[model samples]
Target: MQDKYATLAPALDSPANEGFAITPSDSSDLQQVTRALYVGEGGDLAVEMRDGASLTFKDVPQGSILPLRVRKVLQQTTAAYLVGLC
Candidate 1:
C-alpha cells in the first residue's frame, strides 16, 4: 500500500529543548508518520521527536524547513513526511 502523509500531522514534541540537541541522521524510521512542514525550496524537511511531543518551529511556515536540532533521529523515531493530505 502507498503510505500517505497528512497535511497537519499530530505534534508529538516541541522544537526547543533545554538539555537536548536531537537531529535525524537518516530519517528512515519515520517512514510512517506525516510531518508538518510547508512545501518550499528550503530543502526537504521531516518532523522528528526532539524530546517528547513538540516541534522545532511549531509550524514550518509556508516556505521554510525545521532546523536540524528540532527534528527526529533519522534511523529512529516513527514520523513521516507530508506535502498535503492524502
Candidate 2:
C-alpha cells in the first residue's frame, strides 16, 4: 500500500492514521496518548491529559470529535462508545 502522507512528519494538526476503542478506567492508562477523541455517546467526558491534568468536559454532544491530547479516560466519564485517535 502506498501512503502519500507517510513521508510527512506528524504534527498536532495532522490527520490521525490510527484509532482504538477507549474504555474509561481510573487505574489503567491508555496504551498510547490520544491525538483526539471521538464521542459516540456523549455527556460528561472526564479525562486525564498527557501532562497529567484531570478535566471533565460537560454537556458534550453525541458524535462530537474532540481534538485533545489525552492520556487516560477517567472512570467518572459518563460518555460511552469512546474511540481514541492516534
Candidate 3:
C-alpha cells in the first residue's frame, strides 16, 4: 500500500512531490499518509473517501487524482487545520 502512494513521502522523509502531497501520519492514519502534520498550513483535513482510494483537485484546466484510502487514513490522525489556513 505504501508503494502505491510513491509520491506521498513518509513524514520523516521528503516533502510531497506536488505542493500539497501526503506525508507520514502524525495523527491517526499514519499508515496512509506522511508528515502532512508539519505543513505550513497547520494540517487537519476532512478526507471522506474510503475505498475510493483516490482524491481529486484541479491543477487548472486539467485535474489530478491521488490515493484516497491512504490519504483518508493519514488525515484521520493529522493535527487539526487552523482556521482560514486553507
Candidate 4:
C-alpha cells in the first residue's frame, strides 16, 4: 500500500531563507508551502496567514517538532525556529 504521508528531515540550525526570522514589527514572508511545518525549540510563536488571520503557539519546548496540518500560506512568525517540508 502507498504511504499516507511522506517522511521529513529535521530542521536546520540556520535560517532556511532570507526572511526566516520573524520579527515583532515586520512579518516574514514564506515561500510556497508544499507540506507541513516542523517547529524547533524556542519562545512562543505566532503564525500569520495570508488572509490576515493568525495563530499563536505558546511556550513550545526545545527540540520539539510540531506537525501543523494546514495548507494556508504562511506570512510570518513571532519567535521560533522552524523547518518546512513534506
Specify the highest-lDDT model's number. Answer: 2
Tell me the whole-model lDDT of each prediction, alpha carbons only.
0.36, 0.94, 0.34, 0.47
TM-score of model 2 relative to the true fold? 0.95
Candidate 2: worst-modelled 10 consecutive residues by lDDT: 5-14
Report the C-alpha lDDT of model 2 over 1-86, residue by residue, as the tens digit: 99888888999888888999999999899999999999999799999999999999998999999999999999999999999998
Error of 4 at 9 (Å): 19
TM-score, each model? 0.22, 0.95, 0.18, 0.46
lDDT of 3 at 35: 28
If the candidates were sorted by their TM-score against the true structure, best first, what order would they fall in?
Answer: 2, 4, 1, 3
Superposition-based RMSD of candidate 3 using all C-alpha atoms, in angstroms:
13.9
lDDT for each residue of candidate 1 in 1-86, tens digit (9 for 90 to 100): 54354344544353321232233555343333333332343333434554545433333434543334233433332333323211
Tell me the tens digit of each residue's lDDT in model 3 across 1-86: 36666765455344344333344343443333322322323333444343534343222121222323333433352333211100
lDDT of 4 by residue, 12-82 (tens): 43223322322233343455432345556465656654455667777766665555433342334434566
lDDT winner, 2 or 3: 2
Off by over 4 Å in 2: none
Question: What is candidate 4's CA lDDT for residue 67?
Answer: 51
TM-score computed on alpha carbons, candidate 1: 0.22
